[model samples]
Target: MQIEIVEVLDQERAMVAFNSPVGSAAGVWKGGQGLETGTHHVEFEIPDEVHSWSLVQPTHGAITGGGARGGDFVTVHGQVEGVGEDSVVTLRIGPDVIFVEMEDSVERLNQGDYVTFNSPTVEIYPYQT
Candidate 1:
């Protein structure tokens, strides 16, 4: 996805806006890569070991984070693609595929289940051509 780094918090953290077809989201970018103010192509991943999530009625996919929403946290709403070993799960949010590592097994969640969960951080890696 294409994201704009709106504010630089530090060398490895910044505030970014995700340009998504479904909905836009503002979040704190956490990665080893340094970023300046501007738009860049990048991919995101949930780096935390999530243990719980809430099942919600099917709704439009969206990403929300930062500021009043939650400091250094992100909320993602999407459909479950599948659950794998080691508590890793695949989720399809709009056109982006996000991989989440859960602290607890996600065997209870089946494919196509729409769920929402908050992660403490979302890491962005610049996409290389």
Candidate 2:
């Protein structure tokens, strides 16, 4: 779906918030994937992990297979630790842990629920404001 960049929270980490279609409330992904705040035409495979985030990969599970060095690391295969305010989803993958800021439009996730995203790429197009 087409989306607009709402806020650039962590440009260095590519953690920018995007405005959902509805408005006001925004969503964030693990990486920027070369996206900047403005108008962006994006095609994302919605994840069932409440957050419904997409990763910028060419093939599913190829980069995270060991060390391919892709910035899109949202494929956190583990149980959810908790859900905090602002829709931050915390999850655990073995000894490692991850946090995902979810889109308000997504469904809510429960604690201990299994979460994983196999989507390789979230196609993006940057538009000038």
Candidate 3:
């Protein structure tokens, strides 16, 4: 998905925002070279293990701040894309697929399950192609 790098937080991090078919979301930059403020095609990765998540009624997918963990944490709402044997769960969030590492086993998730959870970090990487 394409996102605007709204603010640079540090050498390797920035604040990113995007609007899509599912909804709008703003999250902290994760992986990638230091970027200038502009629009870029990127992929999102949740580096921290998501300890809490649950199936929810189908709703608009979004990434927002103010997670219960607080301090740069983010909340993500989306549908489960797939559960890998290695515990990495793919999430479909508003026209984008984000790879998330789950803290717990992903056995409970099924394809297309709508879910939401909080994570300490949401990383965005510049993508070419």
Candidate 4:
């Protein structure tokens, strides 16, 4: 159930939509990790943080953010130090080390992958001039 961040709708709320495989796979994304992944056209409201976000354009992926309410699911993104050891993926967001579980068990995230921890990430969408 690997998905790609497709659009940014409400920046203030950190609301966004990600595109996943059609059918049941899509449902899996919306239901787990407290990420509360949304269905088609569903906008997820990403919780906020006390610190300001640092943004940059990724060479290969898009960005999104969320945090678990009162929990450690902080909105973090950085180069993947490693990924998926039976459902857990580790990310290094600056000086902090963060761990994320792959709710969508089918997807394979890899090392050196750049993920969120910043806002307004510059995504170069394929477009027509």
Off by over 4 Å in 3: 11-34, 66-71
Q: Flag the better candidate by lDDT, 1 or 2.
A: 1
Pairs that collide, model 4: 30-37, 77-116, 77-117
lDDT tens digits, residues 1-129, model 1?
766665564444465555546455565565545567677777777777787888899876667775444456678888988888877788888777888886654777899989888877666777655
Model 3: lowest-lDDT 10 consecutive positions: 64-73
lDDT by residue (1-129, candidate 2, tens digit) is: 345676665555454555433222223444346656776654333234343543222321211311122344423344667888877777554443455556653245677666555433322234334
Q: Per-residue lDDT for 3-49 in model 4, tens only? A: 45444444544434455332111111233223433323332222222
Error of 4 at 126 (Å): 43
Question: What is candidate 3's TM-score against the reference?
Answer: 0.76
The root-mean-square deviation over C-alpha atoms between each candidate and the true structure, in angstroms, is 2.7, 14.0, 3.4, 14.8
Give the Cα lDDT of each candidate.
0.71, 0.45, 0.71, 0.38
TM-score of 4: 0.32
**By lDDT, is 1 or 4 better?**
1
Top candidate on TM-score is 1
Greater lDDT among 2 and 4 belongs to: 2
Q: Which scores greater on TM-score, model 1 or model 2?
A: 1
CA shift at 34, candidate 4, in angstroms? 28
Comparison by lDDT, 2 against 3, better one? 3
